[model samples]
Target chain A: MTKELLEGNFAMAEAAVRAGCEAYFGYPITPQTEILEWMSHRMPELKRTFLQAESEVAAINMVYGAACTGTRVMSSSSSPGVSLMMEGLSYIAGTEVPVVLIDVVRGGPGLGNIAPAQSDYNQLNHGGGHGDYHQIVLAPASVQEAIDMTVLAFELAEKYRNIVVVMADGSVGQMMEPAELPEMRPVTRIQGDWPVTGNVGRPPRVLTSIYIDPPAEEVYNHKILNKWYDIQANEIRYKEYYLDDADFVVVGFGTAGRIALTSVRAARAEGIKVGLLRPITTSPFPFSQLDELSKRAQGMLVVEMNTGQMLDDVRLAAKGRLPVEFYGRPGGMMPFPDDILGEIRRLAHTPLTTEGDPRKRWMDRVRTGELMLR
Target chain B: MQTEIVFAGFGGQGALFAGQIMAFTGMDAGLAVTWMPSYGPEMRGGTANCQVIISDEEIGSPLTRTPLAAVIMNLPSLDKFEDRIAPGGVMIVNSSLVNRQPTRTDVDWLMIPAQEIAESLGNRRLLNMVMLGALLQKLPVISIEALEKGLDVHLPERHRKFLKPNIEAIRQGAAFARGELTVEATPGANGHEPEVIPPTSV
Candidate 1:
């Protein structure tokens, strides 16, 4: 086990190389530019394909084109750049191409700043493109998990013949940590009958998404939905900390989830039965787990860097059996551990107050020196 | 055990590099480590800072709001980060540039003429290594020998010749920090006395 210190972007690039990814197509965007920068030299030196596309749209199309040949291809971008790639991603999903896409999230709406945020949760989990399709979204909180999930993204993409998305915040992309990289796998071009081959041995295979017949389109939609159902049943991943016996459960994902663990620990030190549930896969979200855990908790708090984007899912998972509360710091801001602890204390002690802004409550406590962990 | 440190200075002063070296040394020693810099397209001469966290267990967050130690190379960095150090924490300030004394009396402050010592050694770029040596003297989070090995891996091949000088500068720094090598006050040294406080266990 060789351990080396690596940043998030470099780790993802190394994982892609180790996974025998054949091609990379991407455009430069803040927080995610390092992924493209690292691959620019590595892919060439490894004798693999790499391209710096003119724009994110062109990059996703390049990924689509490479995937059509049954090659392992990937592209990455931040919020604005990802927004531009939705069209091509929709086309790729409609065509059922197995491609990997990474979104190093930043504050969004339009061309947001290069700071970490979970604002892209909606765009990634819910289909951003116009189609009845879903991308398998995996969210990693740490650099090590980033490397592990990135390698898994390729295998899952290949297994389901669908696009896979690795959703990470800018914090994970920028931070450096000691990571145990997976060993390199032998590069082998996938020779399958599904992809279009230039006429040497088999019949022509046309990979298209346009279904002129309504009945055929409906059948295709059902096929895709069945695949999604299978993924939900078999691919849902999550980690539970101190939830064996807890009256309050805190739910989050990605960076927000990682920070919540600190708050949960501090709350536990104070004898509060507060636990954490971090969802690893956001699309085939661990709804069943959340539903089961909800029955054992007094209430649930959904923390995020966005304005409650993932709260709806938690509510649906609870099915009105438990009260769901949300606390968020939107616009690329992050809440400290003490901030979440204060909220946990408030929620565990009293009902949701309707006094001042819930978002500003923690900041106000900090001003008065009341926001403390212990 | 866990230690949170902030390295701050001008962009060209290599605070980021020092932080990376600390993180690398911690990782090589089989400790969990994280290094984060003040990123976003800033060129040389602008303010720069990097946060490093070394712990024996998994780290929850990479960013540190209150650092247990700080290495400040310039006056601006000191003025900005001096008070952010935790109570009973330690700080190493480059006495060659900073003139004012720290206002916080609760922390231990080590004033080392790192840049001057490096210049006297015929290389001004080894200032960060000198500061690193002094840091090791105070905390010994990682050994100097391990740091030397880290340089072997982290230093660029073209600049490998400076490894010896860098190690020498670090030794001089450790000596000055230990009061084995006394430094006379130069211009801008402000005749500030180096304050030493017993190390606090984290």
Candidate 2:
């Protein structure tokens, strides 16, 4: 059974239904409130727990409680609210509790407006909560992807016994489109793997992000790097749209990826060879495929809603092999598809002989850790 | 491909519903849509607004700095959004609520006394629907037929009977349109039309 018309938030709730998560706990925030609202409305019918916590702080803890009980559980919020949940998330990461967190990112810095912005790329990619850790973050571009990624998020989180985050933005949370609902299972799986349930028959488990002081910095770095590397090898996913024959590859994620796909289609119609390399999982950055495509393409255009955040990743993946260009809008500006096509054309035709602009060069050096923030 | 608009006014004035119906109507037309309402202490008698986007393609930013159009159900709405409409956009004001007209000459202004219209219709609850009607007339992206079809789809199963008059309102609004705005076909492969429908001028 499938429904043709559904809202993005509703679609995510539907994904939650399919995943059979035990609880849906969250606080309301712009662009993201719909998910909580939908769950609240639909939970009763499904006989699931839907609690609107007092604050994001309480909401994340509720998810932690449910997850600790060894049940599939999830929570979500926008940027500010997610920031509040980071402390709890770090704890979840430490204990390796399998819970999914959806960050429907909006603009940032302070109490930024409720609009879609990918400014949190660094936050989720680097594990914004605190301590030495990282969260599995998946970026979804369209409404359908938001739902699809949601099911995959739960699967990955449970498989690794870790925290999985479906990082989206206001656009993904608020948009409505036609989506085919996936099927539901007949068997009600017993969710009893929680770390803190302390059930009589199972061994008692503890969940915490606390780690005593490690003896050396290198030890911690190596330990974390191993996990990140594992994620990189096993989880890296990038979508290539008409990339088999292309002069340029537009690298983007989330909403930008959708726009880039549209651009690729338009460029193909005009006889210009262009394709898009969409990063499905941002934290587990897909560098291998990008490395392979770098030899074939003349240049790479990295588009983002942030200023040169992903451009750094593009450079890392390409290793200075291809000329890289960046086109971005900060705070809350979404680039038009025409602008994306224009960038692709300009970057594809332009030569790579130049060392790029002085400021851009300086910024790249600053970004690469050759320089530090004052 | 998407035009995000915000309709704002007092809580009971049907401001949020105006944007919601537009979203629902757009969805019925096979266009992606989103509706968001502002909720807080300030939202009571203070101010209220709903953000809505009607799009033929995938919507990127759910929020907009400048909406393609705005409907000010009260003085605070106009005062807050009069300067925020995009260049050559439209601002439809409820004359019954706001005495002051649009101070800016950049956006097309429509002064519809919605309270009076609702009174004539024997129900003030229809203010939002009346504003919706005017918007459906002025903004031709989604057809009158589409809006009617959307109301029937969105108005709940048991109360779906209300869709008849709502559909009639749309037709009336369509008949009231003064200028000629042809129905724009879906944009070609470009996904964006450089100049599809004639730009609405102030």
Candidate 3:
């Protein structure tokens, strides 16, 4: 319908509304308070339900309860808050309930400052709560993407039959940009046909993330793995900005990519053909895209607000074929454009460290075009 | 070309709403626009601000430390943002709310006694409309007709009838600009100064 300049967090809420989110239960957190506020205001207008959940734990349990009823449910919090919801997250994944959780990352092992951090990467992508299950994690770099990804999370969560977490940093939650509000069309209701809720249907559906025996466990894990593989195949998304002709590239996602985008423009002004590879989907990691660009880019620099979560992932994916360096400011301090430019400048003069490190074997294969998305 | 602006002031003033009008007006004029308010803890009874960016091309960043112009509802915002404004940028201020004068002569500054002008109009709630008028005076950002249309579009149906006084408030506010207007023109709208009109009678 109409386009509004919505904040990233509000865009997430609007996207949820567009995706036919039946109910919302969340607490207020920095960079993400707007979602709670927006949903509170908007839901009533549309005759939907929104609750100010008592605590992160209560909120997530509420989401689990709603998802058990097969409703499109959502819960959002920052890193520390997400930690509290891990028990529920594990339950949601274990029960194989289709739901969406948003972790707007902020600095932290604790009550880290309200700044954005990507440290939750390992936690989210690798099963933060516990178990062998992985949440379909989608990272959005801009407000517009926040809307799109939140809507997509519903589709992916249902397709893969798992919890989909839209992970972002403070900057992503805070940035404001021109976003097209979805036409105020009604969302068709979602029904999980696994037959879990009742016997009234044609067949009974038992939804559970449990394995009864070795063969069953193998089968279950195999099934989960297959779904993941398909996600990798069909949904690995990223953007290539000025990368076709470039000497160096900056790899980042969420807010880090946004700050770096402005710098990339400046770096271009200085006659440095530095491009950007922004991951629109962080979980499927978009390794294949980075691998392809490595052939053309002389080198690459991975920038993140965390110490090295995404950087390690990039290094692992790049296989050292290109000189991959990183600059990080963990715990709530966002990297300014100048810091990014400095990293770009430093990488320009340094030679690729292709040998003798911990990842030497991996890099060896990467340089010879042998590294892959294993 | 596109223009970006921010109107900052203490909470309870018209800064956020003023920014909203400017943005909606731009949108009504068919320009791509974004109006974002300060989110989180900062928007309490503390300072509140809204950012409005109107661009013919797609706008990249929504939060900018620098803007093509600014409308400062008070002194702190002026102190906080004046140095960063584009050198030749325009500034519209509520002189009565701010106690200090700007030291820079490079940029254009319109020191309108906005709150006073609003009070002189029959209601103090028109504080934002005055700032809106002053903003319109400085930049051809939105046509007067477009702004009135925008307010009509955004205000609730019950409030739409208040448009005339709001327009008058904005007009008087625009005229309150130091050189752009004379103080007498605003204070003379009714039988007396709107600043002393008293809320109950309005």
Candidate 4:
């Protein structure tokens, strides 16, 4: 396939279409409105389902309903809109239906400005909705990665009968780059026995989240937990750079991770032995891999677009074996490569320790306006 | 092996489209490219800009703090982006709209009357193409042939009639940068006399 200049949102929408997505339900929001806009015409042209629901809440429930029929269904929105979908997402999880979601995250606790951010790390990875359910989360840093991951999200969602989210920052959704889209596949509906397909040839099937019996609900909860275990065991993925003989390592995911790569390369050029580890799957995070990196590296730095949301997970993975430093830009701000490079230089020169909270130390530097110095 | 360029102007001046053309040309030439626009609650006449990065290696960050080149289409764009160019960078200024000289002495400058050239070419909207031509002539980041091909592939069908004039505008702007064409001294649309800043090389 020839490469085309594609925006991330439009590419993901087209990739979903080619991946046999039969229905799409979404509302419009900045930095991600193109996805919904593209689907509005493309889905209908293909004789597939596309609905511009009254609100994000209604859109997510539409996704839930479509997923119940074992059809490839998806909905995309930014941070606040995704928040509205949380209730519906929890319902889908409880029902154990396969669904895909694209969350082009923007900054905010509420009604934040529209800009690139990774603040939803905990919201998506740590189970935003109630219950002991886990959603498989894939974070892509580039337009090409976004396309590939959108196709993979459908496969992963169905493989585990769980919700799979392709989480990206507003940058990935808004940026344009050259990428080859996948060939169109004919829409195929799942013919599995689990789907509620009219129940004509067998006993009537009931698919609902209502396990009123406490013991039975506990048993179902255990099943969901066990499936998460399988996902964790089989789905951890990450990308590594310059880690073969490094003395220090930097960890980040999504946009933050790619920006750190620029700093890692700069640090390497200056003869500093620094490397980068970018996690692709944020939910099934590469915990064991970080443990191995901890044994070899003297110190670690965790970079993010939020205020140390993923740092806690990195700390758990490092297991206090080495010092961990932190740096972040919260509330719709993105860090330049030079900013991350400054943090790398500090990590190289300063003495290492895990004695204090890394976030506190970072906050102290931020308070003094030291991080802003060139 | 890498060049970061910023296109800045008002919201309706095609700054984003100009940057998109550069990105498309770079990609068609088999280089890694990224184009990111300054998106927000922008009105039609408000400031707008976009950054384009072309690299031989994988791009880490799409946005750049220091651009290697810039196309300043309006006075506000010049005021906002003049100091952000990297040392030894190239800047193509639209002399028709901007009346002052750039304060920086370390970077090269090509002052072309982009609005005048576009007007002579029969469309004021070709101002971006003119400035883009000047940049291509100065920096040679991508070939003019590749740029033409990009337009052929990416230009919307509704505006296909302007393809020839757009190409001509680009050529005229390149000629102006090459010192083959001269812009007459005339008052700008804002009633301020246009400045004739000569092309400078550091």
Best by TM-score: 4
True contacts kept of each: 0.51, 0.16, 0.16, 0.73
lDDT of 1 by residue, A1-374 (tens): 68888899989988999999989999998898889999999999999999998999999999999899989899999999999999999999999989999999998778778889999898899869998999999999999999999999999999999999999989999989899899999887667778775768767789998999999999999999999999988999988888988999999999999889878988999999989999999889899899998788888889999987788898889887777777787788877777788789987998754334444554566458675422
The Cα error of candidate 4 at residue A363, in Å, is 0.7
Q: Any residue pairs clashing in model 1, and if so which? A: none
Is 2 or 4 the stronger prediction by DockQ? 4
Expressed as tens digits, the lDDT of each residue in A1-374 for candidate 3 is 66665668878988898788888999998868888999998888888889998899999999888787767778888888899999888878777778898888887888877767888888898768876677788888777788888988988887777889999877678755557866555645566565246678376666665666778877766777777788888988887788878889998887778668767876888888899998888888888888887877788887777766777778777777877776666677666566577667766765666454423433454458553311
Write one digit per residue (lDDT tens) for candidate 4, span B65-87.
88999999879889999998999
**What is candidate 4's lDDT per residue for A68-165, written digit by digit as tens?**
88899999999999999999999999999999999999989899989999999999999689887999999999999999999999999999999999
Q: Give lDDT tens digits, candidate 1, residues B1-202.
A: 6799999887767788889889988898889898977775452347778899999987776765678899998788899888789898989999877887788898888988887798899977788889989988887888988998988887777778988998898899889889999775476456453232222110
- Cα error, residue A106 of model 1, in Å, equals 1.5
- lDDT of all predictions: 0.86, 0.73, 0.76, 0.90
Candidate 3 residues lying further than 4 Å off, grouped into runs, are: A5-11, A28-34, A37-53, A107-109, A113-119, A169-178, A183-193, A200-205, A210-215, A327-374, B178-180, B184-202
Q: In model 3, what is the error at residue A149, expressed in angstroms? A: 1.8
Better of 1 and 3 by lDDT: 1
lDDT of 2 by residue, A209-266 (tens): 5556666545654676677667767887767788888888889998888867767777
- Complex DockQ per candidate: 0.55, 0.16, 0.19, 0.73
Candidate 3: residue A367 Cα off by (Å): 33
- What docking grade applies to model 3? incorrect
| Candidate 1 TM-score over all chains jointly | 0.92
Q: TM-score of the candidate numbered 4?
A: 0.96
